[model samples]
Structure formats: C-alpha cells, structure tokens
Target: MLLAQRLPQAGTRPSWPRRLRAWLPAVPALLFLVVFFVVPVVEILQGGLYNADGVLSTAQFARMTHTPVYAKVMLTTFWIAFLTAALSVVLGYPIAYLLARLTARARERWLLWIMLPFWTSYLVKTYAWMLLLSKTGVLTTIASHLGLIADTSTLAPSMMGVLIGMVHAMLPLAVMTMLPIMQGINTQLVQAAETLGADRATGFFTIFLPLSEPGAAAAGLLVFITSLGFFIVPALLGSPKESMIAQLVISSVLELFDLRFAGALSTVLLLCSILVFYVYDRVVGLSSLSGDAPRPKGGQGGRALPVLLAIGRAAGKLHFHRAGRVPGNRGLKLYTWAAVLLLVLPIAFVVPLAFTRSPFVAFPPDLFSLKWFGAFLSSAVWQAALWRSLAVGFSTAVLALALGFGATLALSRMSGRYSKPLFAMFIAPLIVPRIVIAVGLLYLFARLGLTGSDAGLVIGHTVLAIPYVVVTLSASFKRFDWRLDDAAKMLGASGFTRVRTVLLPLLASSLGAAFLFAFIVSFDDLTIAIFVSGGLNTTLPKQMWDDIQLAVTPTLAAVATSLVFLVAFVVWLSSYFKRHSY
Candidate 1:
C-alpha cells in the first residue's frame, strides 16, 4: 500500500566520507606521478625553449635539425626497434608456445633454460655475444673451420649481428611476457577447429592466431621500446654504420659536451619512440595481453615435442589424466630440448673465453690465464666505476622501490575501474622508450643544476626502475588477502604499523624480488646513465660500454665473469628466500 510513497527516495550516491575512503589509497601514487613523472616530462619538452644565458631561444632546436645526421639516426633507431621486435616475435613465439602447452614440471625446468642467460648481467650478456661473434670468435672460427664461410670476417660487426645479439637480450623478456597469456588460452579451441576439418594452417590463422595477437603485440611493443634505448649491445657489437639515437644522445653529452643540444636530441628520440608506440596501440589493443597460465610442471618449455601428442600417450599410461590428448607429443619433447640448447649457445661461449690466455678472444685457445681477472679487479678506472655503480645501483633500487610501493599501496584498495587505468598510467615509462625519459630528465635536471651529478643519475634511473617495481608489486598485491589487514586493524593498530607488521611481512617476496630486479635494471642500464651522469658517475654498464668501444681485452672478460656470478647469486638468493618463506 505504501509502494508509491517509497518511490520518492533521493539519490544513493556515496557520501564524502565513503568517497574519501575509496580515494585514500590513490593519494600517494597521484602525488608521486605529479612530482616525478609529470613534472620531469613538462620540463624536458620546455627545455629547448630556454638556454644558459637566462634567455629563451630556438638555437638548440635549430642546431638539432640543421644536419641530416640526427634525422638519419632517428630513422635508424626506429627501424632497428622494428627489426628487433620482429626478430624477437619469431624466436620467442615457439619457446612461449612450448611453455604454455607443456607440463608444469617441464615449464619449471625450461625457465632455468630461459633465465640462465637472462639472469646474468646485461653487459655480461653482451660481452658473451662479443666472444661468440668476434672475427675469430667461436661461431666465426667454427664456420671457417667447417668451410661454411671464406673467413672469420663473415661474423664481424654489422647490423645483422647487432640485431641477433639484441634479439638474444630481448627474447627472454618477450617469452616471459607472452607465455602466461598463451597458457591462459584453452588448448581445446584449436583442437575443435581440427576436428571440424580445419587443417593446421586454417586453425592457426582463424582461431589461435587472432587470440594470441595481444601477447605478440605487447611483447613486440616491449622489444621496440627497450631496443630504442639500447647502447651497450650496438656500441659493443656493431660498427659505425648502425649508430642509433642512443649513440647520438651520448655523443651530444660526452663527445660534444653540448648539454643543450644533447637535451634537444634526447627530446627528439623520446618523441619518435612515443609516436611509434602510439601507432602500435592504435593497431592492437594492449589490454588483451593481460594474463596467461602460471607454472605447469618440470618447466613448460621442456615438452615442445610431447605437447604435440598428449592424448594418445595419456591413454597408454595407467595413471594418465590431464594430458590425455595433445599432438606432436614426442616431437615436441625433442624440440623443447633443442630450444633449451639454442637459448644457451650465445652465452655458453664465455666459459671457454674466460680461461683463454689470448689478450684478444680466440677459439681453441693455445693458453689460459687469470691475468685479465687480476687487471679488471685492480684497474683504478674500472674499480672506481664499479664502486660507483654499486652505490648508484643500491640507491636507485631503494628509490624505485619506495616510489612503487607508495603508488601500489595507494592503488591496491581502490574499488573503481580507475585503478586499472591508474596502473596503466604508471606503466607509461616502460612502454615509452628510455630515450624519452632520459632526455626529459636531462633537460629538467640541467636547469636545476642536477645534470651529470649523482643525484641526477639516481633520479633518471629511479624513473626507469619504478615501473619494474610496480609490475612485481602489483602482482603480489592482487594475491593478498584483505582480511589480514582488517584483522590487524581490529586488534588495534595504526596504518603505518599495520603496513609494517602486516603488509610488509606478507609482501616480503615481492619486495625482495622487486628490489633485486630494480637493482639489476638500473645496474644494467647504459643509455640514461651515459647522458645524464656524463663521466662523473659512470655506472658499471657505461664503463664496460666505453671499454668495449675503446678496445676489447681479457680484462673486460674478467669483469664480465664477475658480473655473471653476482647476478646469478642475487637471483638465486631471491628464489631461495621465496621458497623458504610462508
């Protein structure tokens, strides 16, 4: 009888208190983005408009476009990224397919194969490439010995070699990002097409291909962005013809010492990368590559051959269950083993090269010595850079971790769809080339007298590493149970105490992994460190970079060997701590 009267109620919108509760978690993140991300970018774009004379001018901008070299270099940068992205897509897809389709145990074992080279230092990884592709390097000597090439000159520095090494560096990341998405796809979709008389080609093109495009495009985006900022790989392994924007940026800074022009150059490089990335997103939506299957068994990559024929074998076994029917099972298994070996070949050259007595790299060494190691450890120039690298690396890690945690913690409790969008905003630095961020920071910092200083390098690196921390921490956050925090609050705890005692304790693995990963990324970085720090704070990677370009010797190899072990140790410790924890 009172139904009509009940219809007069007012709007049920959340009150200010509820809105405040909902928005609280976002405050810290918003503040950080505004301060570090937005401000730096604004200053960078505005850099060319002003000069050291305290007056505005277009001299820097005019200087940038006056010559065709930068323009050519910019074009070169784009194509390299495109080529690198294409190469990674081809090599990474098959490996990712294996990991996604294979047993859980196989997946674990395969990751060791995927990660062994990747977990090694980036510069060390590049040095390993140096050994494999040198004039008398392992690959060249073998090809000549087998009469595959006329001489060792065939494998010497060129664009092709640069692309190959860059692909090697970028492939692991592409596979890791793509595998999970591939795993999430149900294996049955392709089988259904096959049973409907769709042949292998038809099934792949119409069904699986469209489904997996998101991961492919995303991985491609990542490769392209990362490749744009590549300094060490090309600097060490390629010749002058392949000089990229990163090389140009470094020249403007170190060679020319024209801070204004260098900042302008960085601005251009950054803009071009963003333009290409924007086009990629227009072509393929990024959100589609969001998820994938987690660990399967034995490492998923170990069953490339067997995943081709699971059902029949599953029926044959008395205990057959999950993998009852999959094709190419045995062949897939064989292929998986081959895949692992293929991944290892490039980096495996280091073992022999390290022990060689030749001052320069050679195959089937006539001698062995530890002299290089001794030199690497004792050289004042290298030792100073090494110490500097550790200090900057640790600081960069801590800074990134703090910024990431603040943002992630604020974003974690948000209930609105804005959270996803906010997370994407935080992810912008990663997808945009480091060239852009570095340039932006260079321009901004110079005005503040921070350029080429330790503080400047720290700011630049932390900008890059923040995204790494955010990605890892976000995953940990998604898995967290809110009840524990609530439980802590109910028992009488302040927000900081709850975070310290409850949140931090629960996220130890994520924190540790993020820190180590952040350190690795910052340590391995050469592009930003090169321009932003000048020679004042040469990170280990930048030092190796200069050493490689100036000359290659056993001393570089000595440094490479030590870095390999350092990186491997950290990764092992991270995993160990994860396994031992609750």
Candidate 2:
C-alpha cells in the first residue's frame, strides 16, 4: 500500500520493470532492424570502401568509374527511365484528372477498371505482352495475314517491346499516386474562374495544371525510379541494348560472382537516383503539385469530337433495324477480349507446353499432360523453395510494418526543424535504385553470417518495403487528431494507457492497411529478394525469375496463375475488409 501510494504520488519515479514492460512489444522490431537491416547496409558501405580482405580502399569504385561499359549502361538506364516516366505521366494524368472530376460512382468504376491490371500478376503481364507482341503471337499472325510483318522474327523481342511492357506495368502506380491529390482539388475555384470569363483551356493550363503538378511529379518520380532498375521485362522481352541496371547487377553478382563490382555498380545507381531527386526537387516545387484547379460550374468537356460521337450514337439508334447494333459495343468488346486474351496467353501457353509430348517447348504443343506440374509440385527442392519464398515475403512484410509504424510515429511526433530531413530520408528509398540497396545488403550481411539466410532476405525486402509503408501511413497519420490523446489523458489515463486505449485504437485501421499494403509489396518484390537470397532462402518471384531465364515452362505458368489468384484474393479481402471496417 505504501509503495503503490508512492508510485501514484507526484514526481515519483517509475519502476524500471514497468518501463521495460512497456517497451517489450516494440523490441522484436528493433532487434530485427539493427541485426539484419542496419548491419547489411553498413557492410555494403564498408565493402565499397575496401577490398576482399576488408582493408579500406576506393580501388573498386575507381575502376568502375573509369569503365566505359558503366557509362553506357548508366546512359541507357537514364534514357529508358525518362521515357517510361514520361509515358506513365501521359497515360496516368488524364485518368487521374477524370477520376478527380467525376462523381463517386464514376470514380469507383473507373478506378476498378484501371486496377484491372492488378488482377494480373506482373510476371503474367510481361509474359503475356511478349506473346501478344511476339513473332509467333496473335499480333504476328494478324500482321502476317495483313502483310505487315513480312518477317515474323522481327517482332520477337526488341528495345521497343521492353519499353511498351514496362510502361504498362508502371502506369497503374503513377495513377495511384496522383489520385489522392486530385480528389482534394476544389471545384468551386474553377467555377469562379469560369465566371470571371476565362476560357477552359486558359484556366486549366494556368490554374489546374499547376495545382496538380505535385501529384504528377510524385507519380512520375515513382515510375522513373522503379524503371531505373527494371529487370524482368528488359531481360525476357528486350534486346541487349535495352538492358537496365537491375539486369546488369544480376549479371555481376550471379554470372560474374564478383560482389565488389556489384557493390560499386549499385552505389553508382543509387547516387544517380539521388542526383535525379535533387534535380527534381530544385526544378519542380512539391507543394503546387498537390493542389488542383477549380472545376467549372457547368458540365465539362463540350468538345466537338465528343459531340460527334454522341451524334453517331443517336443516328445509329434512329437507323435501328434487325441488325441495328451490329457493332453494339462490338469494337470495345473486341478490344477488351483481345487484351485479356493477350494478357493471359503466355501463362496459358506454358500449361500445355509443360505437359507436351515433345521435349522442346513449342507452339502447337502435342503434349497434353500434367507430368511437369506434378514433378515440379512433388519435388523437395521446389517445395522447400516455395515455402522459403512464402516465409521471406511474410517476414519482410512484418519487418517493414514494424519499422514503418515506429518511424512514422516518431516522424509524426517531431515538428519543424528535424521534420523535412527525416521525412526526406524515409522518402529516399523511393528513388534510390534497388541495385544499390541489394549490393549494400549483400556486403553488409556477409559480414554478419546472414547471407543465404532467411534473415537476410527479410532485411532486404523490408528495406525495399519501408518507403511505401512510410508514405502510406504518413499520409494517414498526418491527418490524425492528437486531441484524442489529450482527451484520454484528461480522463485519467497515463502515457502508456493513452497510447494503448486511444492512439492505438484510432491507428489500428491504418496499421492494418499498412500491413496488407506492405505484404503485397513484399510478395511482389523481386529485386532485393533476388540479390539477398543466395541459396537457402529463395522467394517466389525470384524462383519464377530463374525458371523464366533457364526455361519457360508451363509449370511456371501454373505457378504464375496461382500467384495471380493469391494476389487477387488478398486484394479482394482487403477491399471487403476496408468497406466493412472503414
């Protein structure tokens, strides 16, 4: 009774055990980051500054800098990134603006349509594009019939093919980034501008465009940064000229087995990303980008082309006959069906080919059996690898969410001076190429005996995932009300009690959101997983990548389909939970 009274007394010191108890939940996260994440990066930095024996030196970096091949690869990476960034912005901005301007119903429907790409696995999307655009693909057959491709081989794979495929994969990301800010734009402001007699075009360019600039730039930065280290599409669907930094890094580490050179190359890629970000910040003001121009009071888009299309619809209605609607959305139906078929065909190709009576993977596969799938599914090597990949993805997701939550909390708690730099530091991963982080992890983990371990794979993925989690949670956290804490404390709550009962309750939803988002990010993650998981720990995406490179098999196709269904199911579950919970 005396001790309890003293504990509640003013200015009395808290017991050490109680404070330690409060910290227990956060300990696992802290330990994981320190041992796996922090150590790996430090190792990479140290290795880059030293030789194999670990003596400090800059010889490796110097050699890499002088190599003309590095210069060429760097240039190629830049050009491809720039092009992809531009295309993503071009395709994404209009849709984002439309999403912003539309009614809730229209916006939801449009967004779902845009998100259809997410329904397909990234691997499938790329492979499908290959089939759709390949010499023996549907495009080839049609082109040949029309005498467009005199030589079928010309359409197999090329620089342009890689560009098209990457753009498709990247466009959805660009749209997502811009959608939030666009939704916040004030329509009344635009109406007032129109009332002041400004033309729509003039008002849009002067007002709306600048307001949406920040969102656009952020989206563009995301697309550009991700494009810098693109590997799969470039390797499987592109010519040598299209090789990106990711492909180069993979070759250096795996084929050449030279960790030193890989680390140096990765450092260069990261430095280049930092340079781009610095340049972007200087050139484009981030604030004006998030704002939006006012919407007109009257309905928008009264353009001539739209009117002509409307007229055509009316005429077709008036000319209604037995065959009144021959094209009855037939054009759109054809386009949609064609795209869906093309998107799914590659994986579909692998299924039958896997069971092909013929040993060689070929079209018009005579084989129609499940032998390969059975062999792959039954093999201990594959079974172990599959389990390893699943474990790595989940562990990475957990690691990412923990650090992201703490960092975001710390960031939210901070104000003014230290804020910008810390926020920027968290944001740095967005632009820093994966090659840089991968190399860093490889070097760093090797010192700690973490290489070829599940711990290393988790660290690599967690690092890659942190930026997204931070960005997502930070956006939500910034809007959170701190008054709730005050309210809880006024009602007789202590710091711990307030956090648990008040803060955590409010943030629980966001935490869940962040976790699921992080999970998908980790699941789809290939770069860090590939680099870090040397032997014992292999991720699904990495395994899929190996199979693609070594031999494209139908069992791989089935794997791709399974992965697709998994992602889609998770997304659906998330959506359902979001609706019921939020």
Candidate 3:
C-alpha cells in the first residue's frame, strides 16, 4: 500500500527534470546550429539594419529602393527565378510521370541517369555549357554546317544561355521532388475516370494532375528559392544585363568592398525566400515535399477545381476517336529519353574533350593526347585543392551525421507539439539560400579569425550538409520497424546490446547513404568555399572557378572529367553495397 501511494498517478505529468532529460540528446545539435548557423545568419541580417556607426537605421534599405540599378536587378532576379521554376516543372513533369508508371527496379535504374547531372559539380556543368554554346563549339558548329544561321558568334552571354544552364541544373531536382508524390498517387482513380466515359487525356488531367498539384507546387517553390541565390550560372553564361541579385551581392562584397550593401542585399533575398516559403507552407503545406497529401483547407477547392475540370473536359473533347488507342505514352517515353540524354550530354562531352591534343576546350580533337591529364596530375595547386576538398567533405560528413543521427533519434522517440517546430528548424538550412549562408559565415568567421581556414570550410559545409542528413535519417526512421526493438527488449537484451545488434544493423544502409549525401554536398559546394576560402585555402570548386574565370583550358576539362568519374564510381559503389546488403 505504501509503494502504491508512492507511485505517481496515471494522469500526472512528468517532472521537469524528466522533460529536460528527454531533450538532452538533441542539445548538442541544437547548440551547434545556434552557434554556427543561426548566430551568423542573424548577425548578417542585423548588419543590414545598422549603420557604419552601429546605430540602427534604414539607410541601406533606402539606398536599395532609391537606386534604379538595384531595383532592376532585384526584378530581373525574381523574373528569372520564376521562369526557371516554371520551365523546370513543365519539362520535368513528363519524366516524373513516366518514372511513376515503371516498376520499382526500372524506376531505380532510370533514376541513375536522372541523378547523374544532379551529382555532377555545378562548376563542371557550367563549363560544359560554355563549351557547347561557344562560337566554335559543337552545337554552333553543327548549326553552322546545317546552314541554320549565317553568323557563328555563339549563343552564350545571353538570357537564352542563362535559362539553358539554370533549367538544366534544376530539371533533375524538379523531377525528384515530384516523383514521390506521383508514385503515391492512385492510378486506379484515373482508370475509374476512363471507365466512366472519359478519355485518357481527361482522366489524366482531371484525376492525376489534380492529385499531383501539391508536388508541382512544392517543386516550383523549391526551385524558385534555389534559383534566387544562383550566381554561378548567371556569372558564367549571362551578360551584365542578366545579372541576378546574387551577383550584385557578390560584387558588393568582393569588388566594391561594401559589406553593408552586401548584408542589405542578403537581407532582401532572405526575406523574399522566407515570404515565399511561408505562403507555400500555408497553402500546399511543406509536408508535400515528403509526399504526403495536404489536408484541404477552407476555400482550397473553390475555383481551382472547376478550372481544372473544365480543362479536362476540353481535353477529352479533343481526343482522337479510336479504339484501344493509348495516346502520349510513346511520346512521353521519347521525351523522357531525350531529357536523360540532355542530362548526360555535358558529362559525355567533357570526357572526350579531356583527351584532346588541343590546348583549348573545343570539341572534335585534332588528335588524342593525355597532356592535359598529365598537367592536372603534376600541378601542385590542383593536387592541393583536390586533397583539401576531400578532407573538408569527410569532416563535414562525419560532423553532420553525428549531429543529425542524435537529433533524429531523439525526435523519433518523442511525441509532442515541439517535434514539428524542431524538425522545421533542423531543415531550415535547406530552405534558406546558400549565398546568404555563405555571406553570413564570412562575417562570423572573420570576427572569430577562422576565415580562410579548413575549419571554416568544414563548419560551413556541415551547416549545409545537416539538412540532407536530417531529412534522410528522418525518413529512414519513419520506415523502420520498432517492433524489433520491442522484441529484443522482451528477450532481456540491454539497450546498448539491442541498439548495437539490431538497430544499427537494420539502419546501416540509410546511415551510409546519409553520410554519402553529406559528403557530396560538401565536395560539390562552391558558394561557401568561395566566401570562406578567402583565396588562402582553395577547394576543388574554387580552383575550377578561378581557372574558368581567368582562362578556360583543356586542363580544366581534364579536372572536370576526373571529378565526373570519381563521383560516378562513388555512386556505383554505394548502389552495389545497398543491393548486396539486402
């Protein structure tokens, strides 16, 4: 009776210490982000609000508003981002749709091709576009030979070039974003619609399209936000008139030496991104990114449904009247294959160009030679950059995985209102622009005397990598069978023993994948490296950026080709392990 009285009641709340203990595991990761990510970003944003004397003022914002060039640049930035998002969605929808119809194995195989461009370094891809769109390049040569144009002065340094590069970069992402939602859709609904006297077009438009809207919306939002911070594509392929807000921010810092203006520019960009994210969350729900259908809120179905249904009815009316006719499948397949080809073309072109005897990066070599590859191998600068990238990537992956694993595990064990907000906080890095983070880190690292150091690069990359790690582990945890743990516990296994023998074994593949993703994120990073390297510590991407800006040579192509092969091998090895592990 005394023991029963000593026990807490069923409805009694846990003690404060118990609640605090529940959050203990997550504290390290939370503190890390608060210190490195949140503090730096907040400080930079605050910089924009204060004057040179540290007095709070709106002069920076006033300058942006009053300056015609700044206003034009901001407008141009949004317009380009909007177009990139729209085009990526439009071009990627069919590919995602085709993949959705395939079997799991086939889908996985096709995704290999789709993900190649995504895995390739942005610098490599941008360089490849430069080669293709140059005056004496492959495409221009072909066009010239075919008598399509009288002038052969190249198609680059134009908005068309900018769009091509940006869209190519973003298309794979769009396809990936929409694929999960499309796969979760019930094709049976489309079949039912067809059975009820609707044509194929009508069924797809009314049922499948409506169901896929959330994914499309999510992709658009994500792509637009990502595009806003793009400096590489525009800098390489676009003229000054096509300069983006990111370019202006870069110029303000590097060329103008105006930290205040850079901060103000970053503030505007950050606020715009946050505003867009907020609207997307309220409307489509950010959960759409995870393939979950959002609950319909009030007024969600008001006019959009009627408009979509009307479009479906019109498409149905225009359908060709033929028995057993499955329209668009063949076309979709061909389109998907073409898209795959586009994704691989640049990488394919770079490989052969790496072996060219010519000094320049041009297609159709006069003779084959390995001189450029030899140059790359023998150059101390190149070797240093390569090793530095590997080191930073390794460090970033380890740090991110450790932090993400602990935080994810803690969140998985807890069930409360706090979980959602914490998860959102963890993933905020993904939503925020990379350029903003880069500039912010530059400011913070400068004050701490950590700028231009390997540690700075690792810290910045880890911030970027944590989001990918958290998201990957979160999904893996959700799909895990907790019953195994329960069974092990009932069998008298200790917590350590169960985790070591059961949980770790079951989650090994996911952990490896998350590590690989984090590594790749760090390795492929240029924005952070550009700001953090400070010309003292050069990463592979930073080296490539310098070479591309100063001089484009066959050696650059050789380096790019090597990176492609390395990334491909890594991806293949990962796939092999995953396949054999099962």
Candidate 4:
C-alpha cells in the first residue's frame, strides 16, 4: 500500500474539482479583498499618474514635488516620525526590560497596564492630553502654582505638546513589541558572563543588548511607520507648523478641494511607506510585524552583533559595582515607573475631569456636575451617532470574523509556499497607513454610491479589522487539536458535525475575543469615518473629532469618559473569555 501510494497511478490525473473544492473557503475573502482593498488602492495609486480628463499624465506629480511648501511638509513629516520612533525606543526599552525580568504573574499584571491603554480609543486619549495641557488645564495650573511659569502658560496646540502626546501614544506599542524579543533572550548566557568575573552591567551589555537589537529595530519600525500617518494627536494638539502627511492629505481634500492633488500626495506617502516597509521586512522579516518572536538568521546585523558586544564589554570594564544591589538597577526601576506614569496620566484624568462643574476643562473640580453625561444621553446628535457606531461596529466585527475564520481554515491546509504570500496579503492592510486606506476607499466608494452610507462605513471598518481577526484566529487554529477531529471521525461523525461539536466549542473564546477586538477597532476608527461617513452615518469618533474642532466642550469629556468605560468593560470581558475559554 505504501509503495502504491508513492507511485503514480497509470492513466490518472489530479481531480481539478477536488482541488477547487479545497480552495473554495479562501475565495470569498480573496474576492472581497480584491474588490474593496485592492481596487481602491489601485485607483488611488494610478490616479496620481492621470489628469482630470482621465488621461495618463505626470503633471500633477511634478507640481506636487516641485512646490516648496509641500516639499517642506514632506521633510517635516520624516523628521517628526524619526524623532518619535527614536524617543519611543529610549523611553520604552526600560519598561520592556522590567517586564522581561519580572515573574510570570507579575509580567501578566504589568502587561494589562500597558495593553489596557493600548485598547482605549485614540481620540479619547488625545482629548485627555488636551484637557491636561490647555491654558487653564492641569499642567498649566500646576506650573503656575509652583512658580515654574506664569498662569497663562499653555502647551496645547504646540509642537511640544504634539511630541509629548505622540510619544505617549507610541510608547505602549514600543514596549509590547520589544517585550517578546527580550523574553526570548537566554538568561543562561548572561549568567555565564557573570560567572566569568563580569558584573551585571557587563553581562547585560555584552550578552543581552546585542541579542535584543532585532526587537528594538522592530519596535522602532512600528513606531516610525505609525507616527508618519498620525492624524488625531497632531490634529487636536498640534499647530499648522507641525502638520504631518496625514493631515496634509486630509486638508487637500476638505480644505483645498484638490482631489487630484490629494491623490498625488496620498500616492507619494503610500509609496514612501511601502518603500520603508519593504526595507524593514527585508532586514527584520514580516514575522515581527505580527508580534512574533523573531529568530534572525545570520546576516549583516548578525555580523555586526559581535562588534556591538565588544563595545558593551569595553563599557562594562569601566564600571565596577558591588554584588549587593547591582549599581543603577534601582534607578533603572524608578525610571521605568516614571515612564509608565507618563503613559497612563492622560488616560487617568479623563473621568475625573468629565465630572467637573466648571465650564472649562480644568482639573480638581470647583464643583461636581452630571450635565455633560446627561447631555450625551439626551442629545439627538450624540444618540444617533452612538447608535450608528454600535450598529456598524457590530456588523464589522461579525463580517471580519467570518471572513477571517474561513481564511484561517484554508491557510492551515495549504503548503508553506502558498501560505506565505496569502499571509502577507492578509497582513498588508495593517502595515499600510490608515490615511492611504481612507483615501482609496473614499474614491472607490464614491464611484459605487456607497459613500456616507452605513454599508460603506461597515465595509471600511471590516477591512481594517480583518487583519487583526486573522492574526487572532490563526493562533487559535494552530492550537486546535486535530486528534479530536480524528476521534470524532472514528466515531462516524461527519465533517460538519465535528466542526459543530468539537472545533467550534474549542475555539469559542478565540472567536469571541476576535469579535470584541474587531468591534473596538471599528468603533474607535476616526480616519476611515472621516472619509466614508458623515451626515446620517456619523460614528462616535467622527462626532468627537468635529466637536473638538468646533470647541472642547464638557460634553465631549463626558463622551470620552463613557467610551473609556464601555471599551474597558468589553476588553475585560474579552480577557475573561481568553483566560477560561481555552
């Protein structure tokens, strides 16, 4: 039988129908992506090379790059992104280190602290910074009381404030990305170094730091790419002088009414981002982008690792410390806590400030009031947007999870050669900037008459949510026990019965968690909403964005507070399922 199985049967050909049946599960997701994601991106990129009459032209591109102000904006965007990425690395490394060294239970506790803020709405977090940095806000009040500056001091709407907010937002991502890498490092090597008459500093510098560089590089890439396309933080807390590529792309449409120019700029930004992403993927591998523990094969970075380790050893030779309480360790821990404090401060102040009786967004309330909360509950505009957001969010989550789960099943049965490209396709949306996705989708949806409709918004959110859902469900699928399926088959259970009674039951938690994540992502999405929804299809984030632009009302704080609690509750529920469902 083994020999017969290995030999080709005479007059036999592979069954094309069977092969097609195997591919069927992947077709829906592939077709959906082709029409929605791929088509829009093609339209946006190709639009840059054409004129208003639909004729091919490079005149727009020439004009855009040749303009002095536009060129300056490009340079400024790069500078800010580079600075933010570098700073996030410096600030987040200590926290990642602390997390890596802690016991498993302690790591989980601190991880929740980092991830809770990560799961909160970006707009709410930005608004929290505004409340703290405004002229009459908490920071200014403290500065005045301490005689550090005048009572008129204000940090909001300044480049300084933008940097602060940007860094705060980027730190948690940096830390989480690096934590896996640090955890993968072998502590035994460091102990070996210490036993060879080297101190803790020397062991870390020579043995640990070099091993952790890939993670650091991955963190830097994540932060820089995200910073390049920032909209909410800079839009709310930054001035015109600090405008980024995303803001410019938006202004080109809404303010200048230059769709061609916006398309050209979007193309340029997208190309630059893709170029960077390609380089990072080549250097670090795309696996890191999925938060995988990178196992870098020997290459240029590996060759240079020895040189870095030498430098570390040299630095360690200059510092001698007694074994009792390693030198600077306590100070390092202190700095780690300080960084965590800065990361959490913006989120911590929103609820308290929302209840303040004062009309302005000031801290330590002069009195308490529930009027802001009442306003959010009673106002037609707020209620309508809230309901629309919930509806769209629910739809997006279900659609994404369904598509993602099907794709995951198909991928599991595929050969590595086929799976690799499919995986990249699924993850591409996550790597691309939201600004680019928004512009492309807007252009395509307008042509299809889906713009400003709930269907359009749901489709947009589903596109954004699919990558995350795929990542989550892939993990669950991989962990699934095939032996149980075999047992069911042996017991005369059909494929559908096995899936219903076994696989579904086993993966329930993962599916639920993925659904919740998708919902939160769609609910908090402001960039896509800005392009696809308005008037009748407004989401909570879009409403908040408009309100912030018009005025920082107390009611906005109430909305932020409400969203924070709502999202926190959902996240907590997801975590509960994740813990017990498996």
Q: Pick the candidate with the highest TM-score.
A: 3
Q: Which ten contiguous residues of candidate 1 have the minimum total lDDT?
A: 1-10
Error of 2 at 349 (Å): 9.1
lDDT by residue (1-582, candidate 1, tens digit) is 233233223327546654576566556656766666677766666665679885888878777577787767777877988899898887788778778877876686677667767767667777777777777677778888989778736565888778878887888888887886787787698789768765554454455555666678778888887888887777777888788877776677667866667667666766766777677555554453345332333533223334423432343343322343333456566766776676677666666566778877666654668877788788888887888778888999998888789778867766536665777677777876676677666667767898778887777788778778888787788678877776776677877899899999989878998899888887777767766767645778878877877776777777887887787678776665555444
Residue-wise C-alpha lDDT for candidate 4, range 55-149, written one tens digit per residue: 99998878867888788888888888899999999889888888888887677777666767787888989988888888877786787799987
Model 3 per-residue lDDT tens digits across residues 395-509: 9999999899878877776764777678877888888899999999999999999899999999999999988888778777887877777677667797679768987788888
Q: How much lDDT does candidate 2 score?
A: 0.66
Error of 2 at 279 (Å): 2.0
| Alpha-carbon deviation at 39 in model 4, angstroms | 1.0
Q: Model 4: which ten-residue window has the lowest total lDDT?
A: 2-11
Candidates, ranked, TM-score: 3, 4, 1, 2
lDDT of 3: 0.86
TM-score of 3: 0.94
